[model samples]
Target: MTGIRSGSLVAAVLSLGLLAGCGGGSGNQPESFENFTAEEIYKRGEYELENTRKPKDAVKYFTEVERLYPYSEWAKRALIMQAYSHHRARDYEEARGAAQRFIDTYPGDEDAAYAKYLLALSYYDQIDEIGRDQGLTFQALQSLREVIEQYPDTEYARSAILKFDLAFDHLAAKEMEIGRYYLKRGHYTAAINRFRVVVEEFQTTTHTPEALMRLVEAYLALGLNDQAQTAGAILGHNFRSSPFYQDAYAQLRGHGLQPEARGDSWLTRVYRQVIQGKWL
Candidate 1:
């Protein structure tokens, strides 16, 4: 959510106006935007975006441009600006609607990639903390994947890839939070289920090591020594350097058990996958 540079946007609008051989408007120009030309209205939007620093006001001008001059180049540009202005104003639903309209109306436009990225940001930016609903995180991942898959050569795709990883990691973090909650409440089976999801579905995330360690703790608490040892064995094999692995090792040793794949349980399957380099 970087702020748009006022100077750069103003310069770009000025260049567009000069190229079109049109003036923005004199001081005597009508207060109503209906009397302004497309370029004039667009320039006014840029002015509000930059000088006035009121993105909601900028959205009004941009939306008017699209309404007054539909199918025109200025209208297309204004639509993208509408998306940006709504985003800048922190109106995520409006930003998503504007971005989606741009994508549907001008799919092949050069700014389409930016529209897609903006759509993704509308979801990704809402994933502010792990405690929030995970639905937004899922939506962000889906939209980000669209950007990466659809515009792989663009800079937006590179940025999407980074954000995608963060959002994915955020999912794992949420699982860890819930698993920790269950474990603290002596709900070992419930904690194990949550930790298992991290180990199996989110292994690439940074939370995997901690999940494996938690699996060891939960299984041991349930008198499932074989599963606990298998979990510790997996943790040691893949994340030996992690403090979580050290903790898992100490927990196993305290129970007079060694970290090894000792049963045909889920952790054993995970351990086998780790041995074959199929699991992280």
Candidate 2:
């Protein structure tokens, strides 16, 4: 009986092997292109990204080429492609690092300027609207400044200057936004300080006239009538054609103050006398 059982087990094992052979289950298949060169790997990656539109899959291949052939020309191409893949994926932090790496590693290379440009673009694309946190906007502005200063002859530098102007305008707008908040809350002193900053520091920006107008309003609210009149005069002189000048003039007149062109107001003269402990 034991010999009969052992014979049945042996037949079962033999039948399983026969089925595996019939199913073409070869554990040792011949390798094709298993020893591909670094150039071949880079070409495959570039083809995947350009032709197949598979940037995500191509990233892995490009990274592998870069890692395996760091000294080869193909490796340099792969590094750039890898950075582009990160940019296309909207992974801005990684994209920024990769682009910076390329610029640092190949400063004399023809593509160095392009790599710096991509680094700036990575930050620029991350900027949010005026109402949101402006951390990214500030970062974008800094990156663009670097591009303009370091690569002044590059096409990227021209575009960076334009973008930097817009960024400065946006930052000025943020200061105005905060000043308006203070004005609405009747924190006249704080509002005046912020508006003054915009008018004096960011005077070249588009928001300068608006900021000067806010300063006049804030001074009037604080009962600093002399300051309000001075602000109105400055506004009228600098922005003679601005609608804000007309509004500021109206505000001064509404406060029962005459528009005297050259002399100090009676109230200002009186206040100065009082502060100096003089009465006439």
Candidate 3:
């Protein structure tokens, strides 16, 4: 009875193995993906972009579709999708290259404007803070300006204007940063030029107050007492509540020059008088 039971078990195992082999050898199995037409492929790529959670994987399929149908409409759609996927992946260099290629190849295409916008955005996204290297910031500003100049009627131009404003402040801040360095090193003249640039070009920026304050210090260091007082009066008038105004007032008092209590500072009065030859 024991020998008969063991032989029956071995037969059952062999039958199961044969069935598994037959299942593995099935030749009529369906393909993983359907062989889609060009329009179908383009539609599928759009679907993948909008519906799929895994953008990187979607990019792989889109790129494959592009390579397979270079002359078809599907290929153009796939290229644009591939560039967006690279951007979503934070692969900025790849995105930039893809966008540039699209702009070069399809200048008259409707998507060309979007491609140019993306290329500029890729550069803008890499801007460093004001205290660091501003090479990327400068490039971003240039690219964004190009978009604004070339596509003034597009939505991208409006967005570029906002970005340009931000970049302008950052550039102004960088100049102020260098000015502060010059101030710390006692290179007051060099610092004055940088601060002047901020006042002239970035008048609406937050750095304007600091630049004005630094200008006062620069004039004082140069022994131009009348100019120092004029700068201080402007600082006080424009930024009445600023701590810099109090500091400037103290500096003038320390030099035995009384700050004007009413309209303008005494130095401003003197400067006008000197310019009008009233003091002579």
Candidate 4:
């Protein structure tokens, strides 16, 4: 439901035809489906997913294949289908469980990459918005990292990298939101803490320039002129072309100050690293 759904109508019909070639049974009832062969049951699942769009029903049929033919090839295929179906049905918890089971059971299989991707997607899809709890964002990052690290050669890994960047950016966006809120309320120290996280932990994200500018604003409001200048120094060194850097520079100049590392605060340490080419 989140991201793109795979498979076209033609592909679904072709898959159904292939599964039908393996067996010949058309059952509508649960009892009748139980009596069908694994291939026949799998074909039914495909039909539910593609034809009727009843992903929950598809899950039932796929589960039957796993139950009736646990050691068969159909069982392995059914397990993955079960994961996909649960995801399509928006049952991310079930999707994650099925995908994780597939990964744990068939770590060496070709489908293992896909299973891991699906597991990561289960977490990734749940990162719907920045205002939501960040717990899922962290889980998504961890899972996406696994895909990138373990299955680097796969297409899923490439996609995982893209999604990982977005998720990472999402985290930076949340910090900026909280930092701006504190800044707007004149809570300079609280705002500084939030911005510091963006500078230190999430500096690679697009929010860094703005975070540094916010630090300048907060430090100036608190009369910490040295820290303000240090923040402006970092902004100018790395993001001199950015509008945020321009704003920070103007603010520093308006106060008869300039971007300089003049204090032994944390920001001054960052400035030291910047000048040493060890910080971004």
Residue range 1-280, candidate 2, lDDT tens digits: 9999999878655643443233234562313223455666666666667876877766766777777778588878878778888888787888888888888788888888778888888888876677778787888888899989989998989999998888888888888998999999999888887887786667778888787678778878888777777767666656768998888888889998643333475334533543465522
**TM-score, every prediction:** 0.89, 0.74, 0.70, 0.88
The positional error of residue 191 in candidate 2, measured at the CA in angstroms, is 1.5
TM-score sort, best first: 1, 4, 2, 3
Alpha-carbon lDDT, every model: 0.90, 0.74, 0.73, 0.90
| Model 3 lDDT tens row, 1-280 | 9999999878655543443232234462323223444454454445556766555655655766676678577778778777887887777888888888888877888888788888888888887666778887888889899889988999999999999888889999999999999999999889988987886677778777688778778877887776676767667666769887778778878787643322354446644554565532
Full-model lDDT, candidate 3: 0.73
Candidate 3: Cα lDDT at 110: 85
Q: Model 1 segments beyond 4 Å from truth?
A: 1-31
Cα lDDT for residue 201, model 3? 72
Clashes of each: 0, 0, 0, 0
In model 4, which range of ten residues has the least summed lDDT?
A: 1-10
Off by over 4 Å in 2: 1-40, 47-54, 258-280
Model 1: pairs clashing at backbone N, Cα or C within 3 Å: none
- How does candidate 2 score on lDDT? 0.74
